[model samples]
Target: MAEWLYEAGIGENRAALVSRGTIWKARIELEGTGARVGAILNARLADRSTGKVTLDGGGEALCDPLPPGVTQGGPLRVRIVREAIPEPGRPKLPKAVPSDALPMPGLTLLERITASDVPVRVCRAHEPDLLEQAGWSEVLDEAVTGEIAFPGGALRLSPTPAMTLFDVDGGGPLEPLAVAAAHAVARAIERHGITGSIGVDFPTLANRAARAAVAEAIDAALPQPFERTTVNGFGFLQIVRRRTRPSLPELLRADPIGAETRAELRRIERLPPPPPATHMTTQRIARRLAQQPGWTTELARRSGGTTQFVSAKE
Candidate 1:
């Protein structure tokens, strides 16, 4: 059996000893630093082989369970490591880079849902005004504009019930664009206070350097409020946000239109017929109409020309 003592910070240091065949108690006092700190003490046998190490007086076992062939009469050694926590009121600088240069990319749609007992109103169109009234317009606008100008991205309504997913698209010129796309997605996630799962799909980058850079950019953009874990080997970034309140999607109670509505919109916009009533055909039409001295004669002259004209009032 061997005995040794170890100490860490100021104040009283605690210790316990265990022998292969028997238990022995040891006392050691740590030097005081007079400041709050943390330390760890470790005790080990001198001999490579010894009996099973057991603590005396019902204390927890200390030494490694498997003895590494300890020899008898070998010198026992004890080591201590100490660490100190900073005092309160310490000023800390921002460790993260500014988000100004790297704009958050993405579009956002807002919907509101009331509690079960609360009265609710259903409107015809997605109301941007209502979202503005709720104080979310600025946040959404900033996120979308940041994403568009900074990177190859666009913000869209997240289809999930209680979560908003900022889908980052790496449009064309794959490698460098993918890296920018990832950074933009990360920035949007942070600025919007989006909670729940955020899934970002980066375009495939053939170059190893480009991939690594994109990964680094992602790490830099995620905020501390959420736990971010990267699957580098698998090429994915997973984020878990600590959420307190319902996200924008949940608050807005907006449901993404189904495939039917999307197809209909495409059909209407690409209609084979002439332009719609609201379509702008000529840049000078408004000015010419405003300055017209004789409206009937001016209209008659324009009608004979090859250019088709539509009256603004009509």
Candidate 2:
């Protein structure tokens, strides 16, 4: 077995731990008070020949040996040491810019959109003056409620000011669905004011004319503020939108998952405290049983017991 030693903190506030070879180290700078504090240390041993031995700050204690089937190794040891160090100066915050001024130019923007089993929208535009002025309130509001419906299903926006990528999925064959999806993509590009490299993956189309039509629809939907947009040979539509401020998504602080959606998700995953089963899970199981009504009764009879059905907890 390998031995490892670790130390942290300084003076009376120090702590140490020793164990098998695996160990972690961290450096922390302290300030002001040098009050008396307690220190802790631990050690352990492990291997095929010897099961495991553990030691704490107080002293070492023998542990029950492993079972015959288990493999053993050599003893493991850990140690920690602490020492006092001088404190450092606090970090300074950047000065705020005036609201009226326009954001600096030559900033890059990126966004990702997803619409498969769930819909998500993300945007990552460089920080800008206009966005700072609005305090990010307006941008957040627009991104969440903005629902774009395709013929197959509708997509709701989920924006972020970090790198964004859009993933497209086929929602089954429906003419209106394809057109609506294309339009939604066009609007998202304009609304986010995304710049730099942009890539979009659309549903695969077997017919060349249908592909051309989708590209044409995207071109027509774009607003005049977007100076130019071209469809490349590989079926990617590129565009440059006029920028006056940071894109709306940049200013907002929101997550991809909302409260209601999170709650629904928990139900779907059947996650909750133990003992109480979730109603959602119970209902799903019940539905399955209903589909094959004889399963429950047959299981109970084979097990030599009466079947007990309990309602699921919410």
Candidate 3:
């Protein structure tokens, strides 16, 4: 059975689909990247040439190209394709707002995940570590350093502007072990969200059948809707998976909610008796803490004061 571990950190909610002690899926929901997809909005073309549109909600959206014969500043309807990410001025709208796109409010990602009949547990107290729980520490290490080390050899994963490359280096002649390594690579890719093009450098095999079998082994291990290159004479194979957003490395680097929450928690732990009654943070963090009633109750129980979180701007 699959269970989901949810940690409602300050600015984001981190969730992992844990089954058999392995993380099958991981999701990080930030305040900025909420579910704005498919949101129908009344808009006007502020500048069709530059693909900027003014939404009814105020502020510009980088909309997709208008259908032919549409004029600038004309009243139009568009659907948001992606939510507001931190990098840009405005979220982007799709080229065509399909009439079928539902007019749905943004739903939190964790709500959608737990709605799948999976047993959901609030894991902020345990301070859950999904990667360690999976017992794939080495695999995760590879994700960090770009190398998955096995007993004999290792697969080096590197990211280029185009694709993530996996170079297999220095393994022995154990066919079964080689096959296992191939499967491990596939699992790593899926678990870490290593999307887009991938290249693998398998140990060069003189025998045609051996090379073919290794290729098949790796091909079977990976997920669907991907293209791959067969193992070449120089022992290289490439796989390409469709990509939209940034990969794991990119997310992990900029992920701040968890770290910030933990930092605040640590400060609370070491706080002296005269703690402040008012806790200040961004509105986003305050909202998340409000959702965790039990956490606030516990906070009050530990510290000798009734504490309330408010947005810093307030």
Give each model's whole-structure lDDT: 0.36, 0.35, 0.63
Clashes of each: 17, 25, 0
Q: Tens digits of per-residue lDDT for model 1 on 1-314?
A: 33222222112232223234221222222222121111112223332343222212111112333334444432222211111211124311101111112222111111111222323333211223232233233443343333333455554435253335554554667666766766666655543445566655555555677677877777776656666554344345566775433332332232112211222222223333343434333334434434443432332332332223344555
How do all the candidates rank in terms of TM-score, highest first?
A: 3, 1, 2
Give lDDT: candidate 1, residue 270.
32
TM-score per candidate: 0.33, 0.31, 0.65
Q: After superposition, how far is residue 2 of candidate 1 from its true place, in Å?
A: 63
Evaluated at residue 85, the lDDT of candidate 2 is 17
Stretches of candidate 3 above 4 Å error?
34-65, 79-102, 105-107, 115-118, 126-143, 150-152, 174-178, 254-314
After superposition, the stretches of candidate 1 with alpha carbons farther than 4 Å from their true spots are 1-150, 155-164, 231-235, 254-314
lDDT tens digits, residues 1-314, model 2? 31111111111011111123211111111212221111222334434343333333333322333333433343333221111111123211111111122222211111111112222222112222222132222333444454444456654543323223343544667445556667877666555544333455455565667667776777788655554344444444544543323233332222223222222222322222231222333545554444444544443333344333333753
Question: C-alpha displacement of 159 in model 2, angstroms?
Answer: 7.0
Model 1 worst lDDT window (10 residues): 91-100
